[model samples]
Target: MKTNILSLTAIMVVSLQGFSSALETDAPETITSMGQIAEIAHATQEFFWQLVPPMDDPLYIHPDGIVRAVDWKKFKNKDFTSQMTAEMKTVSSSMYPVYRLTVIETRTGELLWHNSLDQLVWQTPAPLDYNPYFFAFEHWNVDSTEALDTQNLLWGRSSNVGAEILLLPEAFMESYEEDVALEAEAAALAAPMAMMLLSPPTVTNLMLAIGVESNEVEVGVYFPSGYTNPVDVFVCSSLMDWDWSLFTNVSSVGISEFTWIDETATNSSSHFWVAA
Candidate 1:
């Protein structure tokens, strides 16, 4: 009887090992919903890295040839607030079953903000622009014509590491023409400048990288800095549609006579003034 019991115990151990192996091998090939969102965000970040200058490269030079770049690492390791998380959660709540999103910082990999595509509050009630949804905090100077034009600076790191310069000259022109036409039609009405620099379609690339069918059909610019305070915003979609000539003209002419235009429309339906 004792011998039989020993044999039974050995068989049980082997059976458990086999079960564990099976579980490991069959571990669902499907990506989790959260994983998909994270993957897209990661892809966007990588794209930003490719567009900007190398960390050691100089972004600008003075008459004496001084160089600079934005160092984004400075904003690392910060904690997320409950309110920010709630805002992101609201966005996620809207897009049930289909997709969910989470917001996190690039520096320390901390989830500072997040929301689902469904929870986003669309004031205009049009199809959602993915760029603004992902990067809600980004902002930039509307009247910094020189920065927008000659500087070719798009998103900058706090430490001066420059990335994603706007090179599309045509997009700038189209934006300028549109703004000018709108102003003319309005007859002294103020309108915010439509021109914005953005990163390429990294989100799509990211979806491809992860080997999943990305539901994220469209992309847009994400300004981490809100309209009130200007910071470098990321460009992902509508980049090809922008008019680059607007920047060129501004860079050539300077902002001495520049006047304040209308404020930019916020994701929350607020407005921030812009100068030209």
Candidate 2:
């Protein structure tokens, strides 16, 4: 009887151990892939673009047929003309693309003067005085006094012609460093998420965490289950800013998990996690 009792006790312990091991083996957590992180990054960018405003501004035109305002005094002086000529030469040497400046007499619709499309320099028939207003269009350097003179001629002449000035718009202007810096903040946030999509299939789960305080920023990922080995993570950030548009600072986190299981057990509870 004693022997039978001891045997039954040993059998019960063995059965309990087997049951516990079976329960552990029955449920396995799944690993996440890098592709999922990329999808999230793309979606976030699309959302940001849609939320931003258009970058272009309205054209500046005078009541008369001039595209810009002109200052006659600067054009009339010999010293001013010489300085402007030298500046124009420097601008030409820069190999910048030429823009046409068209001066038209609105009353007769006749072209009065045209400058080289390759060179913005203009030899005015005479130093401009307040009279005989004219309208003009040209690609003028934003930094050049000569360009300012051209713009002034257009504006001053338009005032005389009593015609409205019209200007063609450009798609993009100059980039601002400050704007780029701000945009970089957002890009840095999104890049990690994008990097996740570059991983292989061994990953089954991933998690991302981002935090920022004052000037300090932190990013982390958690891999609680599925992956048997440590995975690599990459992060990147770039700054870009343009004169016409605004960008929001964005931050993102990405994670990837990996696992190994038999093909036949793929659909079984052993291959995935279950929440209570």
Candidates' RMSD to native: 27.6, 32.0
Weakest 10 consecutive residues of candidate 2 by summed lDDT: 4-13
Q: Could you say which candidate leads in lDDT?
A: 2
- Residue 126 of model 2: what lDDT? 30
1-276 per-residue lDDT for model 1 (tens digits): 011111101000111011111101111123323333334444445333222332332322001111111122232323311111111111112211111223333222232223232232111122233331122123343433343433333333321211111111122334433443554546424433322222222312211101001221121222222222222222121222222122111221222222222222212221111111
TM-score of each: 0.20, 0.16
Error of 2 at 66 (Å): 42
Whole-structure CA lDDT of model 2:
0.26
Q: Which candidate leads the pack in TM-score?
A: 1
Q: What is the per-residue lDDT of model 2 for residues 1-276, given as tens digits with 9 covering 90 to 100?
A: 011111101000111011111101111211122122223322332222211222121111111221222222333444422322111211112322212232323222332322323232332233244222222222222433444553344332321221122121121112222333455556558654322111111223444333323322334434644434443433222111212221111222233422222232223222111110
For all candidates in order, the CA lDDT equals 0.23, 0.26
